[model samples]
Target: MASYRGAPYIAEQLQSILKELGANDEVVIVDDASPDNTIEVIRSITDPRIRLIESPQNRGYVRSFEAAVAASRGEYIFLSDQDDVWIPGRVAAMVVALESARVVASNFEMLGGGPRPWIPRLLPAWDRKPIANLLGVMIGYRAYYGCGMAFRRDMVPVFTPIPSYVHESHDLWLAICGNLSRSITHLEKSTLLRRLHDSNETPAGFRSLGRIIAARVMLARLILEARRRLKR
Candidate 1:
């Protein structure tokens, strides 16, 4: 999990996740030097499974999640946002899916009737089409949110060093690696309650044509990079 100024809601989110985790399961969180009491709230949780890493400086969530992934010791890695609540079966569902696939992406619903998503929810049939999945990601259709995704530990090298130019959409970069390798699985159920608000890093609104084109170019470059890494 990547945490910023999440003091207002992180405690509730952590409570939701902690219940689902076992004694051996772990939650790795990297706090990006939040100015708020985010760090304090995390420490108050008192769970041995919760591992919090404090960043010396604010490096944005991309690098924070990267650092958290690096420090994680689990064979299965789950990405999470600090303020969202995980559903009861999320860990079990995604872990079961990951047994056969390198990566798994799931659907999500709005929390407390938060703003509705602009794109359509993901369907189970979509998992079978790798080409379509790649194109969906390229055009910004597939909802490959980090909060709803999980991957195997072996994919760490493939997903990280997250393309120097990618300041955002690290989850999309992971989706690209999964799809490029044709090893992604789509879960039909909503795994978590996504809490979308103004502070959310992912833009909920549409992008300008220029920004859209730039994102496409970035996705293309990510595909090439992922292909090269997989070849090695």
Candidate 2:
């Protein structure tokens, strides 16, 4: 989990995570030099499985994720947003999907109210099969919402060398890298209540057109790089 100035909802998010996860499960929370009392909120949790790492300085989302993954002990690592609430059975469903695949992505519902008109405008309905269809599906949107993704720890080495330029969308880079050897499983169940507040890092609605195009272009570049590495 990566957090910055998320004190308002961080405690609730941590509690929900603890409730859903088993004792054996480990939750690593990384504070990206948040100016708020996010650290104090996390300290009150009182769970041994919950580990807090304070960054000496602020690192952006990409580097924060890198730091978290480096410190985690689980064979499977689940990426979480500091404000979202993971519904019951979310982790179990993800575990099932990851059984045969390296990357498993679950769906999430937009909370803080019902859907907005721009929601559909931004995310159109499309078929999920043939996998190749994802190339285009991935163009204008995030294929695996970062908050809902799960991956094997073994795959981290392959994902680490990814350039920081693509750090903002590291989940997309992971999906593209594992696309060939491991099928990207999309779980139909809504595992998380994704909060869309003013501080969200992801672009929403028609305002994200530029980011969409840039992400697609980056995806193409990563695909080519993957191919080259395979040839070697």
Candidate 3:
């Protein structure tokens, strides 16, 4: 997990994590040197399974995640967001999926103070039925949400030192790398309650014509770069 200025909810998130994790499970939290009290809050949690790594300085999400995964000892690593809530049974389900697939991702529901946001509400309706096929469609588009996915430790080397300039989305990069070695699977069940807050890297919105075009352009650039690297 990569954390920056998420002190307000880090404690709650950790509590939820501790509750869900089994005695054998291990968690590694990487603090990206938040200017806030995130580090202090994490230190207060006294669990042997939870190990905290404090970066000497601030690193962006991409680099921080790379560092965290590199330092992790778990055979299967689940990416986590500092603010989201993981529903019970998430780890068990993910473990089953990873046993046969290179990557596994689950569906998520967005929740907040009021009626569901327009984007979240429209997702299930706008997309086709039986979301299983959504995985194939994601190859040409970005589909994997970081917090909803997990992968085997053996695949870590493929993603480390993330190429400095892939205009493509982060999760897209993970899916692409996983595809090089094995197939990515999408679990039918919702494993997490993904919270939508102002601090999200990308805004939540339904797909519009402009947004579709932009996504295509970004995916194209990413594909070209991948091809170029393979050719070399």
lDDT of 2 at 77: 93
Per-residue lDDT tens digits of candidate 2, residues 127-170? 23425534643654345577888888767776666665676777
Worst 10 residues of 2 by lDDT: 118-127
What TM-score against the true fold does each predicted structure earn? 0.96, 0.86, 0.78
lDDT of 1 by residue, 118-220 (tens): 7777777877898898888987777688889999988988998787898899999999999888888899889999887789877667679998899899999
lDDT of 3 by residue, 1-232 (tens): 8898888877877887788887888778888889989988888888888888899898677777787888888788898888888888888888998998767767777655345333222132312232333334344333567788888876676666567764325676676655544456667777777777788754465678887777666655655554454344
| Models sorted by TM-score, best on top | 1, 2, 3
Clashes of 1: 0
Could you give me the TM-score of model 3 versus the true structure?
0.78
Best model per lDDT: 1
**Model 2 segments more than 4 A misplaced:** 116-134, 207-213, 228-232
| Each prediction's RMSD to truth | 1.2, 3.3, 4.7
* Residue pairs in clash, model 1: none
Q: How well does candidate 3 score on lDDT at residue 86? A: 84
Instruction: Look at candidate 1 and tell me the lDDT of residue 30.
Output: 94
